[model samples]
Target: MFVWLTQFILFRLAFGMALLLSTDLLASKQLALNSQTADFPVVSYCVDPDWLPYEAIRNNQHVGMSFDYMTYIGVLAEINFSLIKTESWSETLDKLKNGECQVASMLNRSPEREKYLLFTRPFFVGANVLVSNVDQPFLQGYENIGEQVLGTVANYRQAEYIKNYYPNIKLKLVDTELAGLKSLASGDIDLFVGSLLSINAQIQKSGFSNLRIAGIAEPQDILGMGVANGDQVLLKKLDTAIAQLPEWVHVDIYKQWNNVRVIDEIDPRYIFGGIGVFICLIIIGIWWQLIIRRYNGKLVAKNSQLQALQNELVEKNRRLEFMSMRDPLTSMFNRHFMQDRVEQEKQVSLRTNVPLCLILIDIDYFKAVNDQHGHVVGDLVLQEIATIVCSTIRDMDVAARWGGEEFIVLCPNSNLDDAIKLANRLKDAVSGFDFNTVGHLTCSFGVAQHYAKESFVEWFDRADKALYTAKDTGRNTIIAAK
Candidate 1:
């Protein structure tokens, strides 16, 4: 029995040793396969040659957020990137289209780009802002941009979006963001749209204190790397690398580039002077106490005067607040005030499951009137139209001067059909009303109801399209969006 047991133990030991050796061989084979798979060919990449804080080609070297992200991703994926120089973003896009470059370091994905490139998942997201001269009033939104000559970078996603949605806005395309900003600073363009980071960086670098952010624009910048559509393998590798990236790495890179510090140092002389002033105040307080009884009547009169000044100051502030939310000529709500009201009403409509609608009105041939009758007469015409619109709509509805020769109405608890009816009434009122010197004028209207879960921009876009259709078909008409 002892000899039989010893033979069984020996058999078990041999079997275990063979299984361990097989497992080791399989692991070694997998390691070799992985190493071979990581050996990818060098990639040629292009960047916006002038965009800073995001990506740029400076002195023939690639630098900025894109560079840092690609460096880490390349190390992880075992790929190499070679810089392909270009003079401008437009040129960079041209090179990518013609296959001169295999990748774009950072750009927003667009339908036109999808024809030739495959985009990786977005790695960086930032807001887009409207920039204008310091003297310009705060813009309500892009939908109210009117006929201003807006500047945008050539080949930028924003340029395409504005062209497709807000066709009324006159776009002046520049080669780069820097060029566009410079143009804006020089008053060559009314406004410029760009990513917040790049805009801030350029403004600081160039000391463009004359320019200020007017307002936030629709559609934030969602940026990702783009690879040539033909290179599926490279695209897959890049996607995997981006997915494997740590969240901390993103925060770190953003901080490294965007961190702004303001250091305020106090001079010792100022500190000493402040101390001396405090001491003098204490001595003065003691002296004043001795004279307090003698000056009681004077103090009472002085306090009365101060109180009257405070009352006047309060009244002025109230008037200022009212003026801020109103168009001076029309005495109606301005676009800035209406934007906030629309957001609030939208939220209420969503929460209560009630209906919300918007109507856009444009004065037909209004510019002709301005040219023929001059701006003073044109102002009177606008004021009259505003009054007619106010009288035509219900008190629950909100109206605002959308921009030059344009206005918007927001209706709560109203459906498309009801909104269309309201717009018709407004159109008829404006058509029948007579401007004293300008004679009779007509208006075009576009009406749209908010769809469930749709964004403000989408709703506004539908209405804007309808308004354009009304103009195209003929003036003095109302059209409802489907």
Candidate 2:
């Protein structure tokens, strides 16, 4: 899946004919298979008409790698993706935001878009590279761009990345990659950086034989399809359809455009950027050909196999994400999740006009146990406490080990009395439980009800003090903030 998407994203950068060819009238291929299927949805979407290799509109038709991939997905799912006419990428984005378009293609995920768009799993990784005239060699180090005028698409995130991070670089903002290349060709801008495929396409059309890739940029882009936030049904259907296509189609479609080469296992975001990794992987996986042939022979069996793989992939990704949010030692929610989830839970209570509570617990004399039983037994005690707390608390309550032997719980829709009761219950449970020949142990707990208009830290501080009171007054007890 990664190979196909990466190939899907960078496939336009194919060497040789792609570099030499100027006009092939690139457009999406329509599929006639399984049109009679009943579950097919007629999805309305808009594409960026000027973004080549990824998407483009030439002679009034939606075309490019993105459109072709979607058309193939439509065939697999028996859906009709009706294209909505739009003038530019900005207009396409506006249509999506305004609900005129139900879907938008080739979207990069970011913090801002989450408010309006639900992004699907990324379809491919984009390795953005600098494009300059061959005569003017440039370095990949971002510092080299300090004194140069860089041409980039206006309102594009890359423009923002450059402006915000490298303010020293003079920006020559253009409306499209073609415009950027044009600006570069005219020497109006020192150089331009864009998707490898996009710059190559523009270079082929510009008749600029001197145009060559200058350098690859950091943080390679991840491209995904987006539906308006809250449109889960459409998003699920689209993801499922896209996942079912034979992986080779991702590579095959690109091969028709240009010859590709792989560089390394590069994410560009974190490591050395590798080109043509997908092609190399595809070459090595010869057995998949039998499955592909069988799929072509029998759609039902192939669909079943693809669906199984899709489920497995989804499950694995979910588990990985879930595992990342926990403390490995105690199998409790980690401090990182505590920080984020507390904010989320606070917002939920505020939105619903309900009370929230926080409880902080510290294992009394935890150091003594570690000193006597050793670190291994101390770890076991923490794990056992986590299990006891999780099982004793309400299902809606969240539990986390803040640090060391101190555990915190976030209780939604609970008031002072309710929180105190639960905290006392937790304290008693800890006091009663046996610790595998390590003898008995007690915990100090502080409980506080959230007050309206109070900051999270303020409320937490109150609870934390009450917990220390538990420690000072006596262990194995709960104290609620007065």
Q: Which one is best on lDDT?
A: 1
Highest TM-score against the true fold, candidate: 1
The sequence of per-residue lDDT tens digits that candidate 1 reaches over residues 1-482 is 23322432353343334433545542343244334433546788899888888888887777789987886566456566778898888889899999999999999877688788877766786767788886566676697678788999878999888888888889999988889999998989999998777877776556565676777776667688988846867877887778666666687778777743222355698778668756765889767555655566775675565445444433433444445567988999888767756765675577458899999999999999989989999998999999999999996798999899999999988998899899888888888887899888999999999998888889999999999999999888899998
Q: Tell me model 2's lDDT, rounded to 2 decimals.
A: 0.71
Give the root-mean-square deviation of each candidate in angstroms. Answer: 21.2, 16.9
Clashing pairs in 2: 5-124, 262-275, 262-276, 263-275, 264-274
Q: lDDT for each of the candidates?
A: 0.78, 0.71
Q: Estimated TM-score per prediction?
A: 0.48, 0.47
Which stretches of candidate 1 lie above 4 Å from their native place? 1-38, 135-137, 260-482
Model 2, residue 231: distance off in Å is 0.8
Off by over 4 Å in 2: 1-39, 134-138, 259-482
How much is 249 displaced in model 2, in angstroms? Answer: 1.3
